[model samples]
Target: MPRRPSGINDLDLAIYGHIAEGGELTLSEISRLSGRSKGVIFRHLRKLSALGVIEVREVGGVLLASPSRSPRRVIAMGIMRAAEYPYVLGILRGLRDIYGPVRVLVYEDAWREAQDLLSGRIQLAMVPALTALVANRLGGGRVQIIGGGSGGGMGVVRGTGGSGHAVVRTSNTELCAERLGLDGPRSYFGGPGDILGALVSGKVHEGVLWEPYLSMASASGLRVEQCEIEHCCLLSANSGVADQYGKISRIAAAAISSARSADLQAYAKLVDLPVQLVESSVRGYSFHEAPDVAYLERMLDAARRALLPGSSVRDAVVA
Candidate 1:
């Protein structure tokens, strides 16, 4: 299943890029450039036009799209829906309440989110702490950890001690395997959905997963155990938009607290999971409005010990 789409997506951006390259682009030109059908180009242009990021006009009976301002997409990717719930509430609802409608993209993993974020295609992204660090290094002082990340919520479900066939592995998930000395070969999973799929497909019996995925694993008759590594995910922003970090973090935190008390059906739908799973998954984790200085330092130390590639601490984090 795909994540919910509330704004511009990669395909839309590709179409927009064709227009931004200068001169008005006809539907056929954009479709050919983007490898999408004319109807698909038309559909995406509507939203871009409505958002004032592009202007669609009929010129001499041929419809054309012209670029205005480049679109900005705030992405929230997590191991499960619960992890992104606050950002969805805060950025989607709170941003509208304060600023206006903004594009928000949900993801289940950090791979593409990290790529888009570092390439400036993304305005902001909430991803694993390790990913943010590596991205900051890759972007060369162009990216920074803005705020609003999570701690804890990492564990193993039916994890075998160093000798099993395989266990689910992700950036944050592997922390537990490393901490608990699980030395077995790892089967990498993209996100919560992938982990679930692996379980259902019998590809792996154990998974090192986070919150909601762990809960789902438990519900599937697997035993769960908490890992002591407290580093999970963090919020990273393009340095060009550094000024908005404070406001984004504040709104996200408030929205997180607010959503905790509200009905979780919306979040469930966004993550495409049952409301019960969403509710239970969040119970075991802690969400922060700002960076946790002490834990972050500790995680950085661990990263250094693990010989991970990262920028200096000062450049990576806002703290």
Candidate 2:
């Protein structure tokens, strides 16, 4: 036998039926169609929104609900790379339930490419917080901060002799260098693949990096030295598009919340991937629910401090 729908009342059914034709209709149209007061119809619409049955899109002071969910895209670096892609996949999976479909655009540490992508050249972007600062400085107001993760805790790897050999670091390690009061080395590598290759080949005695890479380096018999620094992830979008940013942030936040709500077994399964990495990369990501003006200002403050001449510590909110 076929099962019936659950938790849907008559009013809900009527509203769905009215919008089932897949075209937007105003409150007046709905009221006229159902012979109900405009106030009553609006009340029902609010209920539907609260239940996640519909999305409210505001257009030039008018609110409309499209039959389809809003579109979302993420510009991420190393998105297809083995170490970080899996975690990103998990996060996207959770976001799907809350925000429908999502698309990810990949970049391999080309900040210039990211800038081009963000300047109405592409739909979305996911660059490092440092890169985002550069973008903001260049008047990349079209991009806004939405959500982000704790990429992974970063540290400096040193040789067993405790003497400075060739020093290496991640693309984002500039923050670590500032925190440790060390000017970064003249030469540095970006992607994890490059960094790992340099470490394995003994080209660099010490390096700053995120998890899986760190764990892999340790397992390869390299003496791993921990540096005192906190790494953070950030999401950004075009400044004028606050509504779109809100939608994306909400979806990202919901994904993090869902991941956190998963059982320990599920988290362990996620963490026990083929690669060696930090648990924080998978489970430590978080989001801010009530993000507004003040939150953005704080993020900007932390980002500015991190990019200061010789500062290492940086602050980040998950969403």
Highest-lDDT candidate: 1
Candidate 1 structure lDDT:
0.62
Residues 128-175 of candidate 1: C-alpha lDDT, one tens digit per residue: 776677777877977687666666777777732323323332355555
Candidate 2, residue 95: lDDT = 40
| Per-residue lDDT of 204 in model 1 | 70
Question: What is the TM-score (0 to 1) of candidate 2?
Answer: 0.53
Q: How accurate locally, in lDDT, is each candidate?
A: 0.62, 0.50
Residue range 1-319, candidate 2, lDDT tens digits: 0111244355654675576445687666777888889788778777666555565566776667644363233222223222332334455444434333333445445365346546655444444556655666676365555675444445565534322222223235555544554433333565555766766666665566655566676777776655532324455566644655666666556554454444434333433444324343433233333334454454454455445533233323344
Clashes of each: 1, 15
Residue 152's lDDT in candidate 1: 75
Clashing pairs in 1: 162-183
